[model samples]
Target: MSTNTLYGIFDDEEVLLASVKEIRANNIEIEEVFSPFAIHGLDKALGLKETRMAIMAFIYGCLGLSLGALMIYNIMIVDWPQNIGGKPNFTFYHNMPAFVPILFECTVLFAAHLMSITYLIRCGLFPGGTSDSPDERTTDDKFLMVINVDGDSSPVKEMLTKTGATEINEKEA
Candidate 1:
């Protein structure tokens, strides 16, 4: 499918931020925004919901903790019971304190690694993925706001110009 899109490039981050708010306030649909760095409150201005990554990370952490606990229980209690240094390893509850460090490390490790992988996959930021940006200047000093236009694009263009866009371009995608 092909669509007409208008890209407004702003030189300043503040201008881009204000433009995003104004464009959203006017009820115009914005396809996406590209910038060198994240802008504060941009998600709020774009009316985006809270991300679910943290929740997924917590689930991964719990899974890791459970796995660590199970491994420790099996190795210390079920597989080959040990009584090192007069410390009883017959029950999980009795020896759980010694495994606390391992449990915490595993939880953090799983959460960090899995969440990073999930974020990369979700954002399509793999090693060999093509860039989705319309303009390469957005990777450095410029900010680009993309708007899908149907029928008429003059209104959107005028709005962007009024909002202090440094340059504006359109293309069929």
Candidate 2:
């Protein structure tokens, strides 16, 4: 990864996308793109497909909801019976509104707690973790494009220059 070269930097996403388009039009290899914030249509512009993260989240949420329902029902009805205020201990429908709070709370609790874990696992992100990031300055003020030179440095540089890059540099990787 250290051998990766930085072709240029742009202050705007439009400029970056245009440059990417031109490079791809000429069949050049783009190793990766670095951005501080997400740019609209950027993945599509780069010909990348959507991630399955949301699908995973939905599945995990459903699992949480099922687990919560099972636990609540089993505790309230099967595990132990506690009668209070002359209310039926086993029948939940008599106090629908009160039980609603428990059910709703369970749904939210399951969704939030499990979805976070799912997101972390799916994205490979962990708490207080550090890894390869583009640059501190790039995150705030610039977009960086990395490409493989493939031993044709002159033409590759010329091609990138044509895309209106503000700066260009050749990197080892």
Candidate 3:
């Protein structure tokens, strides 16, 4: 199925932000916005919900900590039961101080690596993936706001123009 989409190109981030608020205020649904760099408060203005990356990271870190502790306990206490420098290794709890470095390293490693992979997958940025951006200039110095037009696009076009869009383009997708 083919759909009509309108692209509003803005030269300034402030203008784009204001335009998004104005367009949403008028009950126009915006599809997406592309910008050269991150704009603070743009997510809130675009009505996006808060991200849960921090929560995911915490979960991942806990998984790593548990695995690290298990590995250390099995190796130092259960398996070999090593006694080095007069330090007690018969119980995992007794040798936990020496295992702190390994536990910390594992937690950091797992959280960082898993979070990176999660971010890439969430963003559809797998290897050999094509860019979803409508305009290449949006990666440079331009900000593009995309709107899906259902019926008449004239009203949306007029609204874009009124909201200080430098240029407007349309495409069928």
TM-score, every prediction: 0.95, 0.81, 0.96
User: Among these predicted structures, which one has the highest TM-score?
Assistant: 3
RMSD for each model, in Å, please? 1.6, 3.0, 1.4
Q: Could you tell me the lDDT of residue 85 within candidate 2?
A: 81
Higher-lDDT candidate of 1 and 2:
1
lDDT (10s digit) by residue, model 1, range 1-173: 45679999999989999999999999998989999998999998888888999999999999999998998888999999978998978788988888999999999999999999999988889888899888888899999999998867889999999999989999876
Q: What are the per-model numbers of colliding residue pairs?
A: 0, 3, 0
Where's the lowest-lDDT run of ten residues in candidate 2? 91-100
TM-score (C-alpha, index-matched) for candidate 2: 0.81
Tens-digit per-residue lDDT, 1-173, candidate 3 = 35689999999999999999999999999999999999999999999999888888889999999999999888888888867998987778877898999999999988988988888888889889999998999999999999999777889999999999999999876
**Better lDDT candidate (1, 3):** 3
Which portions of model 2 miss their true places by more than 4 Å? 1-4, 86-88, 91-97
TM-score of 3: 0.96
lDDT score at residue 73, model 1, on the 0-100 scale: 88
Off by over 4 Å in 1: 1-3
The models' CA-based lDDT, in order, is 0.91, 0.74, 0.92
Error of 1 at 131 (Å): 0.9
List the candidate numbers ranked by TM-score, top first. 3, 1, 2
